[model samples]
Target: MAYEFTKEDLKEIEKLKTKYPEVTPVTLPALWIAQNRFGHVNPEVQKLVAKTLDLPEAHVHGVATFYTQYYKEEKGKHVLDVCTCLSCQLCGGYDILNYLEDKLGIKKGETTDDGMFTLNEVECLGACGYAPMLQVTNDKYVNHLTEEKVDNLIESLKNGEQPEYEKIGMPRRNNIK
Candidate 1:
């Protein structure tokens, strides 16, 4: 199927382009808008972005594929990105990853049969202090995770609820005061 960018999307992309001296930098945000509109940026959508900016399709594809956050294909409603980087690994990130696999009955990099969740083994989400954490749909970070907490998270999501947790804001600079 052909992908069409909404007029609003084009306008947004236009606005973003103006912020940069050249159109190359606009590729990232354009892909973001495409993903938000189409839920994913497959080849066709990448082409659309490239065409919209009058750039090469290969360039758009490269940018989109470079970021793990961008879904190249259609994904489930909820995506679970298990962080298994250095800090998370030391804090038993793999254990959490395995736990989710078993609980969801799907291995890492697989989506649930019910089409609700897609589990991913990601490197880092920049929350080393919140080790053993998994990001919910690239939005919420469930941190300091344990088996019980994971269970609660699953239950809440199953019940059509977004599990809420305390967000650790960026550390305030001591020099500010």
Candidate 2:
């Protein structure tokens, strides 16, 4: 399908352009604006962003392709990013992924039939301490996952309620003094 940025999005992109010295710097924010408006920065959206920013389509395509967070294609309402990086892997990351797959009836990288959730097996979210964690819609991190917690999360999301997770401050850096 075709995609076009709204006037408000264009205004936001215009504001972002002023914050950067070169168009290169604005690519990220411009892509973000397009993604937020269109739900994914597909090829069409990338072309739109490039045309709007007066940059080459190849440059926009390169940036969009480099980041998995950009969502090259459309995704469900909720994208569950399960981390399978080192810490998470050793701590049953695949187990959590399986549980979610079974619970949602959709494997990793696939969305449910209802289009409510899309399961993704992502690399680390930089939350090693919180191994076996998954991010909800690229926003909230649900860490130290368990089957029951996953169940509750699904239910909460299904019911249109944001699950409340406890705040976890990062461990103190030893060299910081």
Per-residue C-alpha lDDT of model 2 across residues 1-177, encoded as one tens digit per residue: 778888898888888888889878899989888888888999999999999999999999999999888999889988999999999999999999999999899999999999999999998799989888999987889988989989999999999988687698877888986
Best by TM-score: 2
Q: Which stretches of candidate 1 lie over 4 Å from their true place?
A: 169-177
* Cα-based lDDT at residue 35, candidate 1: 92
lDDT of 1 at 152: 94
Number of colliding residue pairs in each model: 0, 0
Q: Which candidate comes out best when scored by lDDT?
A: 1
TM-score of every candidate relative to the true structure = 0.88, 0.93
> What C-alpha lDDT does candidate 1 achieve relative to the native structure?
0.92
User: Model 1: per-residue lDDT, tens digit, 1-177?
Assistant: 779998999999999999999999999999999999988899999999999999999999999999998999988888999999999999999999999999999998898889899999999899899898999987899999999999999999989999787667777788986
